[model samples]
Target: MNKPVLDINDFPSKTQLITLSFQHMFAMFGSTILVPQLVGLSPAIALLTSGIATIIFLFITQFKVPAYLGSSFAFITPILIATNFGENPGNAMIGAMAVGITYSLVSLVIWKAGYKWLMRLLPPIVVGPVIMVIGLALSGTAVDMAMNVNDEYSFLHFTAALVTLFAAIVFTVYFKNILSAMPILLGLIIGYIYSAIIGIIDFTAVKEAKWFAMPDFLLPGIHYEFNITSSILLAMVPIVLVTISEHIGHQLVLGKVVNRNYIKDPGLHRSIFADGLGTFVSALLGGPPKTTYGENIGVLAITRVYSVYVIFGAAVLAILFAFFGKAMALIQTIPTAVLGGISILLFGIIASSGLRMLVENKIDFGKNRNLVISSVILVIGIGGAALRFSETFAIEGMALAAIVGVILNLILPGREIVQDEDEIN
Candidate 1:
């Protein structure tokens, strides 16, 4: 294992702390803001609440786990569906609150009964295809944004998207260290520049924006009416299974990185409770759902800095950034085409990650049950199968697929086959 420059409890000088914290902030900024932008929430609110969420998470975990919380990509499609493509984000917020509550409940269960049951419930066969559906389901949106301008096909926009995608791929594949971890931000920067060169970016928002102002926070009962229903719960709460799985995976990897058994020390229940609290607060204040950021984890791996204080400092920085109205405006000015270009790569990576999960787990496609589980999940999820209770409500797409996958996994035989094969090997 590589030696860390700053150990988890090591405190650096003020200047060092500030700089390192800023680095962490920069690492998470791109994806953090991108989620809300895609789902039609305020990027400023995303930044602000993510900062708040991180602080809450750190505090809840006793600042022992050096993990940064940011916007969750897993909830992108769910958020959009709940909000009606940003038409009613308050509904999405309610759904997010439900997700947070679901997390808390799950944490309670884990605390009392242990997490082995969860693993049994959502095996790789169920989780992998659901993750794939998350990315694949958004493929059309990515393509549409990459190729269209104002709903019309544009050659120049397509060129810009291609350039952005190419840059991201190059950075991800060829670069080492921190640069490799920042492919999304680098691709966005390059794409933004290209869009500017093509005279597609509008700078009026940036110009007219104040230097310091409050982020546009959409609060329930203040900005939009708060409403909750079975539809909202059904739409959002089920995705918690995926995100919780993701959270556990992150904790395991982070434990390895920091040379600490975080799951045993801070405990999985504590980390998950913090995550739920973060998501709950973020949603209460109109930000995207918060999850442990992979980018910051990559940063930790590269920089070998594991200080929770550094993570704390970064959270502060993100909050301060949210108040920088001009910067927020600048982020808003980023063209849809540029975002589209990056989303093509970003979303594809998401889909590929699911496949990687299946491969890494050595999910036996040879098994009839395994094959059936994956097949049903992918087709139902990506094919947009829905269980409609009413015109206004339905469990469709990813949520529907996840529920179906879990049920199939539970009922299907051959669960012991993989375990038996592993034992024999």
Candidate 2:
């Protein structure tokens, strides 16, 4: 099949450029919107912040990386656990800002010591399994969402969810070209059409919603009180650690795909700094933490359009969409079943990527230290082991697992895999 365009330097025809941009937009649609929905933040806020984030990310990186910023799935579980405010996610955003600062600090460390020290402190043995737990721990949430996260509409919801899941799988597996990169978008469309046909959608909100209304902007410090907690910080920061590792991988992948040494050109420290700054900005605006979208990267791989300009076009589209209240309201009407169906794949991908990290690194299970470290991290994270600080603050789930893993890796004897090659990244 003919692709739209390929190569970064190739001047794309106007029609091809617009098509490629929209493809990137839909490719990122499901996960980007889902993150805020999962954590009780505004989807409009997420979209708007992501647009602003991508622009800022581009500025910080000197427009070197052709990537779009979107809501990160890593913070979902922690946000739910850390913030008690149901509708107002002020505390959660504060916790998210802490995660970004943690990234900034890590960036500083990487600048001083280079990225190798990070591998030494948290190697694949610890980092890989913790990331796996991040995804696996959320399996229950996906199931609950698919079932409306409640008992209501059990039969109808489950059926709709099944249809959505099946459609996503079919689109992903059967459509092997550029289309394969868009299962989330396709499944969502299928869910929307199905729900409409079944009369499961309530359009009143959409009907009453203004087409040109602006997103409900949230200012964490000014509009809402910024609450901080050590425990919540602890719970959320580990996910930052995960994204740091992912940052390395993403840079490597993007560099390879674009045939440019991004790690050297933009430099890892600068890239991470930009990512941290973008994430912090997102949190300030009451959106989820921002991260580079792998979906857009996949689209780049398919279309062969490596132009950062194309990505900027997608960012503009996202901002426009964010300001369109009726469109966002319509999207909100999507059945929980639809989100549930997509979450299953999205979360599983996160877990599987971590497992792939271990496998690609050829982690030797025979090493008792490696075995023990991974075991502790996975069990604690998956089991929701909480070390409480007070009534409102507690370190549990991924954070607790990460702390334990680092301590165990440091103290345990016979764990000298620090000098391993960077073959995995």
Q: What lDDT tens digits, residue by residue, belong to model 1 across residues 24-65? A: 998999899999889999999999999999999999999899
RMSD of 2: 2.4
Q: Model 2, range 96-151, lDDT digits (tens) per residue?
A: 88878877888888778777678777778888998899899999878888886456
Task: Please give the range of 10 consecutive residues that has the lowest summed lDDT in model 2.
Answer: 416-425
Total clashing pairs for each candidate: 0, 0
Q: Rate the local accuracy (lDDT) of all candidates.
A: 0.90, 0.82
Candidate 1 ranges beyond 4 A from true positions? 417-425
Q: On a 0 to 100 scale, what is the lDDT of residue 309 in model 1?
A: 96
List TM-score per model, in order: 0.97, 0.94
Task: Looking at model 1, report the run of 10 residues with the lowest lDDT sum.
Answer: 416-425
lDDT of 1 at 21: 95
Model 2 pairs whose backbones collide: none
